[model samples]
Target: MKNFISVVVTLFAVSFAKAQIPAGYYDAATGLTGYSLKTKLKEIVTNGHQDKGYGGLWDAYKVGDLDKFYENDNTILDIYSEKPAGPDAYSYTPVTDQCGGTTPGSEGGCYNREHLFPQGFFSSASPMRNDYHHVMPTDNVVNGKRNNYPFGTVGTASWTSTNGSKLGVSSFPGFLGIVFEPIDEFKGDVARSLLYFITRYEDDLQTFNYSDVNNPQDGSKNRGFD
Candidate 1:
């Protein structure tokens, strides 16, 4: 009985420690309750950008003009710049012609901007929309396969991107873990982006697939199980 009690206490302490958020990070305001938070997120996404071609979806992949997208994406770059490592740390140029021998317009290569936190799950708002933390260049078809599926680790992935940059797993032990390998230069940035998504969208988090009840503070929930 004494041994059991000790083990229980130890587990509780570990869980408590894991639940603590990092200092100086964003926390949902108590007053920003219910849909108010959602509204605020949307406002942040659409305020400055011209909506001429801005469809409701966060379709970075479908933007008709790359230059226009870059012009609008400046706001997102600003947000990313304020983080610990900052914007330049997370930015990268897609190998424009390097389709890995895959044909142009093919699903394999042809670089695209991918949303780490899928747009399909949320209404796709600003801050969320323009936030550079979760947005990055990736292959097209792989992005579709990922399509708002919760991140997780899988013993076997159902799909693999042509560039070998992204893949999807069938199952994981904890938190629907999705394993993402970014260019070595941006791994930290991707990790931070995931952390940011969990905290910023905590209320709507359950709306998307999640492996655990704990919020972003505990990386264990929605963590890379592998």
Candidate 2:
């Protein structure tokens, strides 16, 4: 939903790591396929869904968003600002660097919650608004620059962050809209997050507003996935 339509297609990258899904999570959908499998998954995934509210995300990030892989410095591992090959241009301590509303004038200012699926489409509704799976801590300026654009393959970048994430016109076929392209290392994270959003919120997908995307007409059933 949420102008995230293009992401459903651009999600070919392999996840950097895979978590162990709950033991019986997909057992119900085992023999299903196509829409049937999708329906079963909707039931399977949404069964125990809970909303921790918006405040809980900060606490969740403390466990889920820390830097343990690359620099191993225990700073915030921001996908939009992380430079894996060498040192990061800047880094944030978990709580100390969390931003309020004001964004820094530069790239490495402060980190804030970035909704991969965006909150605007659903009017910032519950569960979806606070879904820790899709809401991630990212640099304030880069997050602002991403500004709800659908993730896609960029042909020509209008702007690029220090880590090479881009805000650009789509190079992907069948779409010419503006898109934000995250770096290769994090593309799978973006893809998986968006897919989780779709599955988790399948019932509400039809109602999300996609008018903000380039071709408002594609906001309906197919959700700009043409």
Whole-model Cα lDDT of every candidate shown, in order: 0.43, 0.78
lDDT of 1: 0.43
Write one digit per residue (lDDT tens) for candidate 2, span 1-226. Answer: 4335333323412332256566765577665545455556557667887888999999998998899999888899999999889888999999999997775899878899999887887889987999998999999999999987888889989999999999999998888989999999998888678676775677777777766664222343333233
Which pairs of residues collide in model 2?
none
Q: Evaluated with TM-score, which candidate comes out highest? A: 2
**Candidate 1: Cα lDDT at 14:** 45
- Kindly list the per-residue Cα lDDT of model 1 for residues 1-226, writing each as its tens digit: 3342333233323433655834522243224533344334334433464432322323442342222233344322212122223222233233332234554454533445567776654556554655544676554555555556544444555554433344454354555555543334445445556645554454454455333332223332222211
Q: In model 1, where is the ten-residue run with the lowest total lDDT?
A: 75-84
Question: How accurate locally is residue 47 in candidate 2, as Cα lDDT from 0 to 100?
Answer: 86
